[model samples]
Target chain A: MRGQKDIFIVADNIVSPLGGTTAENFSRLVAGITGVRRQDRPEMADQPFYAALFGSMDGEDLLTEDAAASHAAGGGFTVFERLLASSVADALHQAPGIHPADDRTILIVCSTKGNTHLLDIDDHTPAERISLPGSAAVVARHFGFTQTPIVVSNACISGLLGMITGMRLLRSGLFDNAVVTGADVITKFILSGFGSFQALSPGHCRPFDRDRDGINLGEGAGTMVLSTRREYRHGLRLRGGAVSNDANHISGPSRTGRELGDAIEVALREAGCGAAGVGFISAHGTATAYNDEMEAKAITLAGLNAAPVNSLKGYYGHTLGAAGLIESIVTLASMREGIVVPSAGFETNGVSAPLNICRSLLRGPLDTCLKTASGFGGCNAAVVLSK
Target chain B: MEYITGSCVIDGEGGYKNEKKIFSFAAGSSQPAGYLPALYQHFNWQYPKFFKMDNLSRLGFAAAELLLEGWETGAYQPQEVAVVLSNANSSLDTDYRYTQTTKDIPSPSVFVYTLPNIVTGEICIRHRFKGENAFFLSTGFDPALLTRYVGYLLEAGIARACITGWVEWLGEGFKAALFLIERKETAGAVPFTAGNMDRIFKISMPCE
Candidate 1:
């Protein structure tokens, strides 16, 4: 909704290989570090693939270690579920008034293939328990949320779409607060599936780079507490957001990128901000040739070519459900710091259309930022964040 | 304010328009996959892409086809109509089939249909609806939630009309309820309310 009531992102947390919290991840990003590394998973393939994975380290995983301590009362959570709970738990900790039991609070879990990895032939967990909605319910119940949570699974744009869904819920005055979180763990199923499409990169992904190959899949959780009640004095507000379909292909992106441009234009208009007001543009640069090219075309068509654009895929390696929020959180951090984070792995301009790819950190007065994400199934979403 | 202008349904036996069965399968067969192509032939609708689609996409596309059988094409802008769909199982049938291929080499064709909303994309591609679209996964149909979100889209100027559906493509038993909703008033437009939806979904099918 183009809402009159102000919806603010009061608290956010990112649980990723970069770190366990937003600050930790942002600081690591500022240091030009990446979570992408080569791992040997025979179950996935005979070869080692490059990805951002947080495995059970040294037989005592951090997620398990913490979950056992925090959730001593009840514990049947998978690793991804633990990641989701920890992310939202941290966000709730920051904003205390918006408790899970609050009548005005709603939970929205945005995940693609939440527990699908658990459906291996040998795994004994009931089929329903591994369902996306059921997994969301288990997490919501574990956290004691009173209302039935909603689950969104529209491919890679799931996170951004869920954020917009939460904004609509708040704008409709049906819920004063919404805890939006999304997480998807990498499995052999996804790795092989992307392998079938030849969309997986074996090396570090270079977004908007001439040498870029494809995506390096990752797994993590990102959560943001959206509310009309201001929990922080200097918080980022959800100005406008929109979702659209390419109507061209089921799996392939639009060749012209016109549909994505339409989404960005509408989001900016609803936010009451012109293209010139966007200090920086956060792009959905998957590092694939077509994805980057289409995104650059969309940005230029939106008349936002001059804005410094960057993709966090270089650092986070495309963390599926967590990519949009983690990148948005880092973009907000960069905006708050007045320095645009460098496009971590850019070497040269790659796309047919020219974009001002940020090769290094730049300092300026940044205000409103535009974030865009495109996914399989021709789903595209854009959200504007204003300070 | 929105109105439900059209509805369609398909079950184990055959297809129906507004709860009236237009056709029935030959005796002693529950194979929807085998029956759907024959049904498509019966209607003489030609779209080569329908054969390439999975059972889910086929079900959704055929339902939309029947719903729009006699609809006025100029009723609403294609880019201003949203497609909101929900289902309990999130592409598990296809996911299981894809897993079978993953043992050797994953079939890109099968892997692509592993996402539930690919059906929505197929429908949008057929009709050119570029508006807001979302695929929600819930325990069951939540008419109230659908009413609230669809209402939000209308009030926010994000969409002028919507095609809301609840399609489940589990092998043995499948259900699809496709509704075309428009905000414009017309002679026979019914108020797009939760009560109306609950009433419509509760229609008794003579043959289960």
Candidate 2:
């Protein structure tokens, strides 16, 4: 790896219906709690065929109680941004000594739909005034970060991409410690958009299942503190990561699965590990037909057919931008806790590949896990994390 | 730091028409109806679907295609290159359409294209690039930040080269520019700095 950055996952946090913090979410996942549910919103009543699964938006009220009170006054951010702020606060609380004004520290925010929900509001002025950077800018100003915070919005792979960006900045000696955050809230825009493409699953998502329908939209945020190897500690180490696009299709996945497989192989090689080294695969199993099939094939092609695989989508639903970071956090938690949570809603063995789909929480002394994700534009990313 | 090897801008005026030409669309000033017809005529792209794309996707794809044409397929692999794009208005055209639809009839098709990063995603799929990609939304063009970001990707070995620029599409018009930047051993190459940016603007701007 480009010389070990002493980066340590000093602190991490997650906010989802599965549970609030990382520990809560991991516990619920181990307990096999499926957060997917039928849409109850009156707005979606007309769309009977489509069921909207989402994380609890209760966290929005919690932000007012937290430190981001002033920024939350205007109420421009969606539930996802509040969740992101909560995760950030949780991380900062855990790492009490780290200061944003230190200059040595940086903030990297990732999301696909950063406050796009603001567009749904009646007040066009507020919506137009508050841009994606405004969310990070508010967080930066709140934390007193004088340096420019880096923001990444690379569709579904945004979470993992943020981590990679943070690693680069930290390794380049641009900052000693960086706060990497990812958040994406559900909105009519995203829901209707995916619906238009017929990518959403009407029933519970069944990743890698033979009858896998499609992904249920979910929203949440994941945040972690990454430092150089000199700052590395006992939590988890981001070994290596790579992103690749199929470029074969705009909306559809590549049939060859060459790019996705190549990305996995490249990440593993960069991490100085082999396919066997990955104890489990945290797949981007959006449960969509094309995504699941493509991911399963890519995993098998990477020679990890025997590796226990699970999609956290059942737990948190397909959290678009936050999935990568959220899943990566879950992978690390699984490694540290010695248990691989089951793919929450899987009931049948599906797909052509014989994947060791974890139906029940599997005990582990798991050392390494591969976190993979793919997006609408044929973008795919794979990141390797180790304890 | 690296120098911006080649650059081109195409707007309503039909600026660049060579084998590899960068296309720029200024919101309000250059309408897609006017420029795209000429663009299609010049590129000889017969696909009627080209006209169907919104301003953001159209300008983004055109500029990216132009930049990609300059690189030899064998010289730079898709996996080795990355796209770092920024836009001020994040899919406002789709946003506007979706908003309008909501008032009358909500169309899912128009809603899906509202996200800004779709352009980068489209560019990635078009070029098959997967290396260290990111889409930033800035207040405007900040050459220092852009240069710093591109430099970060290059120095860290994330990508051998970067296709970086600003792409903002509002209503029927847009403005898009791209730079194919590669790291240089010496300072002699044309560095993409604020000074050079100012010079380029002066050269490209209409004479008063």
Candidate 3:
């Protein structure tokens, strides 16, 4: 049997309304600044909706100076592709030794909907361009990647699933490095769909709070480069990750959250870490009544209810596919800096279970952090990261 | 290593199970939209949720039903079974339908199925397989990728049995080739290799 290979976080970048690089985003988060606000775009919705949207220059403006110059001359990449490429490029810039075109490296794209907005423009668009694989291929070629990019489209869990897939492949010796990116842009299509479901919070979302209403959607991209070689700063390791389904409902979360709890337990076991060893948890905390309740129940079931828990949704809203990666990036940064970022919108206990929800930033020595995500299609994922 | 114990294939023409012709469509029968319902009736499966499923979910749900017909008798625990599926087009069929609804009041039912993994969820909901699940989008049927990923899951002991394959639906064209994978090799089961999977998929849908 092959020995288990250690996976390390080499570099990461978060391109969202908060900031461009991971450090910038982390600073803004520590300052208690929220990117979500009221937007009255008639094309997106008849009534104003709260979302964290990029100002005027979606993702193109967030590109590095070198990338911006090239993009100024007709980059031709869509908003979604630009978000992904820019993020991957920024992370790659951090580690110059990790070549995008290396045979030992692989790319994984995670998104709930990529280029689906093109469909709203007109009916004449080619099917290939509107497909997820097409978008992935485009991103892969942008960086001259030698291997075929793997695309994960599993609703909201796509990002974390992408990371897990990369870890598995690397452990299997298929590749030595994995550039995993998760991105999704908000559009009229998505807004209307969530509107139809009545899952959108009219104001800023209050995750795990008594006044919690619904989710506030956001648009952004996050990229994390994972490698077998421990040649990066922070020395954050991808300890263990697991995924599961509720098998109860397609759109609704499990009433019991036992499935999610099982996944969390399995992840902790795989990480060879105990519940008491966990320093903090980054809950999904989408702010929906059912989702927050289910997550709280899952956390309590896993016996980690006493750990300090925070949700980045109050800071970034729910970036859909990008939620897992962006939130994970922030969680790792917090773990590295020994700072427990507060759960922005959390104040009073909203669910039936008791939780140590953080309401203020704290500075303490932290070693390990757990990030959890739940999405449509009853999918749930959890990953353990340690310094 | 894992072995392919059972398999099911569904195309526009008909459906097949373990190399046996379980059912075939009538000559010039319902090309795409109606074949799923007909297959559902042919199997005599009674799940009202079938009607609510989009084409992708309907295709996957029916294929899974056939693939796990006799195998669902507790060979593996509910949490020990996993579903890993992929497709070229990620729910484009449902996307188109939901896009149409977006012009007016987008139907929540239609909007819910816009993601590809919803089919995996439907299968899990129907069979109570609460294990790990994932949905990938590939340019085409990449047997090598599926084989490697499932092998990793089985080797890692993440799942004892996994339902993995390609189920795609776009416009009037749909294909569902599902396989039931397990660690123990049974009589007549084939090794779950990429080459073997490619051959089986080729023979299951000769026209492709």
TM-score of chain A of each: 0.95, 0.93, 0.97
Per-residue CA lDDT of candidate 1, range B1-208, in tens? 7888877877675666765678767856646677678778888988999999998888899889998888776767767889999888888878888888887878999999989889899989988889999999988878888889998898777998888968888656577888888777666667889887766665545435
lDDT of 3 at A310: 89
Model 1 residue A56 lDDT? 49
Lowest summed lDDT window (length 10), candidate 3 chain A:
A57-66
Cα lDDT of model 2 overall? 0.73
Question: Which should have the higher DockQ, number 1 or number 3?
Answer: 3
- Superposed by TM-score, candidate 2 places the C-alpha of residue A67 at a distance from the truth, in angstroms, of 4.4
Clashes of each: 0, 15, 0
| Candidate 3: tens digits of C-alpha lDDT, residues B1-208 | 6899998888876777886778877857656888888877777899998999999999999999999988854878889999999999898888888989888779999999999999999999999999999898998898999999999999989999999999999987888999999998887799999987777676645574
Let me know the TM-score candidate 2 reaches against the reference structure.
0.90
Best model per lDDT: 3
Instruction: Name every residue pair that clashes in candidate 1.
Output: none
> For every model shown, what is its TM-score relative to the native structure?
0.96, 0.90, 0.97
lDDT minimum window of 10 residues, candidate 2 chain A: A49-58
Question: Which residue ranges in model 1 land beyond 4 Å of their true spot?
Answer: A1-3, A57-66, A69-74, A121-125, A230-233, B205-208
